[model samples]
Target: MVRRRLFSVNDHFYQGKPRYFIAECSNYSCFCVHVEGVQNTSCRSYLLFFVSKQRRLFKFIQPRTQLVATQCGVVKRIFFSTGELSGDLQGSILIRALTREALSRNVVVKVRRYISRVVVKSQKTFQLYGLGGSLMKQEGLELLQDTSKISSIGLIEAVPHLWASWSMIQNAIERVIEDPPDIAILIDYVGPNLQLASKLRKIFPGLPIVYYIAPQEWVWGYANQKVPFLLRYVESIGEICDKVYSIFPAEHAYYQRHQIASEYVGHPLFSSDWKKGNETNQKRARESLQLALDAVVIALVPASREQEIRYILPIMAQAAKHIQDQLVDEDVVFIVPCSRDDFRAKIQQQLTRSGVSQFRIYDKTSSSIVIAAANLCIMKSGTVNLEAVAMQVPQLVLYRLSNWSAWLGRNVLGLQIPFIASPNCVEMRLVVPELVQENATAENVSKAALNLLRTKHEQQRMLTDYERIAKVLHCPEGTSRAAKSMFELMQTD
Candidate 1:
């Protein structure tokens, strides 16, 4: 009877060999599952549908608290993986947009065709959960592992300790393998995520894995890790820039050549809503932080990640001290805006040790306001750089990766591209000075800031370049476009 029923269901829903997924039913020891019996093809679909219903019934009884379920019959479980401050922010934005779109449509991903419109009420719902930071928590993603905890560039370089974190990595993979989501959205924080994506593809071979804010190593050179990762793992590419395709056609074309879905989702920063918030809050932002209008304020914006703070905050402080020493009589307000609350004490320690204890560490206000209120910015490379650009503040960018990692990125990888900063990359020239590795010392940073402040002509030139950057980056519907593309991926997915 089961065999006969399976054949009837297969004939109704699809034509080819039926693919099956085992869904465990909780109440009893006899979990309903796919019997891969070549002798019993008839009842396959019917049994699977029955099992899914039983699982839903089990979930309802148990009251699964974490995952969000959609209205359609087949539940669309979406998982996102991200590590680092910027990745957390981008991941949060992407999920919010996806949820908004998903909720608006109120649609499920898969429903058995054998069921009529009257019976369609039996379909499973849409749900999303995954790994990320504080923002993701607010958006309702089940925290798989706090990716924010790994938010250190220098810590990533710590040899044995980094390897010791492999158990956490294994846990992340096991969670996915145990009950995989329909879609896996991998944000930036390339190294670990690429490793995870590669392993994930092995478990769920055909699962649609989409990448947003895809690594920009291609912007530097063809020999970067991006080529192999994209070729081996990613099924789709969602870019943040319009010029990326043109800038790296060979690398960009690799996605198309492999039949992977590709899209030019505009930068998330260019949206009107973000700009309005940045624009409207300038005065209040200053007042709330008690920033005097006439005071000369220079923002020391460093890395949001732990490794970044470990390496960058000290150097940024050294530069700030240099700038302050040069302007002894002038009342200079040095504002260091931290991204995470956990790092606030460490930041205060660094400032105190550097003899810059008087500097205000504003963790309460947005980095946008800090950058907006500043005459100049001395920062490490990250979202903060773009935030500075978004606010039209002239900035000096700096970066220092771990020695061995830096050597590999240069020697083994052959990464010789110029312009580390995003705005500079977009402009195809140095709109702002970039000091990397050894060149990112306090004296060099202080010198650049001094020149920008002292020379009005150079400042104007940089500001004009910023205007062009703003124009290039402006996409009023960036978030909407990204959301739309994700849906398109879902439809064919």
Candidate 2:
């Protein structure tokens, strides 16, 4: 007689507290963990933390496991597509929250993820696969596309990368049709993401599409007469787009006319567990970097892509020089936190070429540490600005584009951006001084930085504005709002 396989949860141990439990199967390919009191009393959530055969760790997916594993329902497959770095970051936060709600009785979520994968046996696991980067990978996201296109507003400039972007779209469409995830989440990659959605909607007519951090469809899609088509495919959105949707008022409106779903759970940046250091942590960061307490630390957050390095970093160089020339006696250290490794050498090289050596370039520097040390930040208009605000660091936000790019957006695309930074856009006021295009010069940026540096009032005003912005932007329920909406829509009869 041969030893038979045990079908039950062969072993279980409470990792930390009494109620929380991790149940391991005899085969060891499948696993489940329960954290009691994590969600509301109406339901219980479970996490699938099993490693696949490939050693890819699929983080927390709520599925029927453990006690009622036999009777619990099947795992819902969520197709996620995050186009830019910010989207990837936001997607990670949203994923964790959703997984937690499946188990959390109290709704509080702790996001922790080196997630690898192995073979997942016949177990109900909410499978999450998408097109994203490291943050998603850390959450065990099976990134579909390798092309991380950092798109900019430029017809001539962005043409070279169009083929690569198209390839990504094709891959996404092929995957959706072939495997066909139960639902799809499209982050702010307007071109490829929208194309993928359009194709998936046609192939899988009822497949739900969630556009998290949904882009300005009015300008990019509607103005071009493409949005109305894409809108038909979208089933949900991560943000409120009534104001944006209203722009295309056909009076007899279609999908673009109605509000899909808004998470309003506050900005994902606020929900992020990436914390700024307290006085102690700040002090430690300063000491480790050998930065003085009185030194004026200016963080230069340039870009995550090549174009930004080519165009934006040079402007930063000029601005830094001007700032140095103006504040002759004040001690300053220009710290650059390079977003991508490909541009790290280039950033250092450019700084060196500019003969600016009173600087430190860190490829993997923590944004929190940089924010903690810096009195002010000179950054490109991106997700990093949100990090600056959360850390209570005053900034002179800036952006520059080639004449061709500027023409492309203004003349060709007919885009009217009131504010590039999200905070400024929130209140319809320039919460921070933003200089763009021709206005973004070394002189203008230095003057702005100097004014903010000299006046304590300006800094305090920013802090005050930040508080107001937080109140307007932060959601107490966190990313769970988005996650819950997605699940409820999927589970609806």
Candidate 3:
């Protein structure tokens, strides 16, 4: 005989008004309670309850998860677009770990993306690794869940297009209304995040939203345009958000300028295992690169993104030639550490097209290894430059934005900072070489690179300065400090 079963909530339901709650005994899907005493149109004690399925139980949208996973949690979701994931997977990884930690404390964490699948975590631990984006569609998640004791980890894929992202994000909010989390941490990916925050405020009006690794509005020269929306969603968070964290003191100024409240929590990069490289690794890497024992190896790292590659690769090839000619028997080898194989192909194509071949491209070697091996580095000014500084590699920085965009930046916005490199920005001085826009030429970069290779005293001084900068930027409390601040606000709300 088929037996009838009642949905067990271990709590009483109010029959006079609509209510929201998770059906824990019934696949844990969100549900609404309709008042039996009142008509559907009656407003005496009626409420709206939107049932939404959470992602603590599915698989990644893509076949392979390309995002970095530093922390573990009950729900695993992708935050940014594949295009934005570009070089570093740190933010994704870090957040995953942080979420997992929160979940261990019995906090219900929900991950929102631009996908349609429901992801739920049934295990207490999980490891997320990127295998060149070739994810096993079915097997890995279950294996991880069983072995690691992970309670739930949903690998939900969103539908394509920005609207789909909005829909998925909205669904996450609806789920939160049924089961509120301690805090909502939106990690980077500014455009979609901003929209999600706005939608969330409408539903979970009191929920605190913390922005991690904020957009470079100052660099984009449009902090003014974006600040208001940021304030609107973050305003409630501001009053009770234990601490609105910022990566730098300058960022606090931006928040203050816009009248948006924030606290200077310091940079995350420095808090990682950013230790100096061993002398032995440096010696071994130099030997593998085929440099003379006494000769200084000047590593040349251009930007990893496709657009940046187009403008920077040619300049690097030319710079290599220039340096070779200027410093007679200087033994300066151009080592390019590429993020993807296509980056290597692009650089090779540029050199082949120009009939030049005098450098080697590095892949197996980590950036830290490259930094340790180099006497000096000529790098594209982005996150990599910061890595170089932490590794004590004195650098000559070069960067070029899209032509049309550069024109608008120069003409309309009038950028305050003369240089684009973060190391220079942190120092508020040209502590390293920066050749931007028209100045990022082969001759200019090569000349600067060669100068450092020959000048030992200057390189040493630069290293000393880098050490100082590292000390200033390093976050003392690490992820816990930021996590605590965000958690306090989320719980209080």
Candidate 4:
């Protein structure tokens, strides 16, 4: 037989046809190729098979397993949890924003959950934790923590001290390091999150931790009680995290001055266009109040929380009463968006006590309905101020802090801008009037409302300025932008 070479093109054949034979090697079921042109092809094949098996069989053969030190990504994790603010609405919205970001990158995000019993409006109730699950499940991401257990602040705190917890965190670190995330963001809460970051650092020193809207370090001068502990924990965070996003620009500047690397992503609220209640919806709300479409409707948002309702709502109710009598055929209504039915009841009780039942307090309608129906708004300053500006509803911003914060604002920070609304801040002028601290009273609020409602040109100018601010803030489809940024950060060395 000619026995033509099984493989083509060989340089070292001494014979006419380079014939090869296959032999089954002894005691084990091993196969060998005999190359006529090459010496001891069986030995070479054996060595080759040995290496292939090693590569296939060994778990630590991957380059990532060889060096844990070079991995540069988020390490250790902590979360801030405060008992007061029910982050449900904010967390729900944020998870939705993050979902779109994760989907485009082809990455599966896993989140855990827990639940806690909290006092809402002085009534005990259980609120869900793990806002990410519902949104994550919709996008087909893997989830870890029990939504019921992860939400409980007390349970998370019991870890390490009361329960065997390091294993869980270590496993999470392993997964993260395997495919390091572009960024690890810790939002809002200062207590638990700071500790979590510190723990992760011990496991993976190279990981970066970004603190979003960090605790009030500037407010306490970086040396006060919890401030020092936070400062130390954040030092490791600064070492690991490439960026820290702050809620207030001034807060960012403060971190910079203190030598922490930080940036201002601007408030996430600014990125949203607070929906102006639909035209039909606004019309329906206006009709319900029995006001002419031409007759200006003003929105009054007092503090919605029970304590706020007790102290601030009556004042606003009084202001509404004042405006109700003066503007004939004009509509003024108190629109209080409540988280629960009980909150609505609490607000109604206050309305009765104040003798302002003539003014309707809306608990069920959309906030945009209130904002769009009204030409002007009177609201307590916080997130609402930003919303008013977004909707182009000219507003009067108001706030009253405890004496200490007020004193710090006056003697220490000396922030140039007094009015908290974004339109006013961007314009560097009082487009909206702010009655803060001692000034947040019914009489002052009413007087300010009169000035704004009566002056047509002033209202128009404020609206124009607000429109400009809105243009400045309308971030281009933040999900894609944020996703791109996140992906790019992950790919970095």
Model 4 lDDT tens row, 241-279: 556655555566667876887655555555552131233
TM-score of 3: 0.64
> Of 3 and 4, which scores higher on TM-score?
3
What C-alpha lDDT values do all the predictions have?
Answer: 0.62, 0.63, 0.52, 0.47
The lowest-lDDT stretch of 10 consecutive residues in candidate 2 is 1-10
Off by over 4 Å in 1: 1-73, 108-125, 151-161, 221-260, 272-281, 402-413
Backbone clashes, each candidate: 16, 23, 45, 18
Candidate 2 to native Cα RMSD, angstroms: 11.5
What lDDT score is found at residue 211 in candidate 4?
Answer: 62
lDDT of 2 by residue, 121-178 (tens): 2332466787887777777677886445546545666787788888877877776555
List where candidate 3 sits over 4 angstroms from the true fold. 1-87, 96-183, 217-243, 256-259, 273-281, 284-295, 354-356, 489-493
Per-model TM-score on C-alpha atoms: 0.76, 0.74, 0.64, 0.58
Q: Superposing all C-alpha atoms, what RMSD in Å does each candidate have to the true structure?
A: 7.8, 11.5, 12.5, 17.0
Q: What is the lDDT for 447 in model 1?
A: 90
Instruction: Kindly list the per-residue Cα lDDT of model 3 for residues 116-170, writing each as its tens digit.
Output: 3333433432222211111111213111111101011001111124454455456
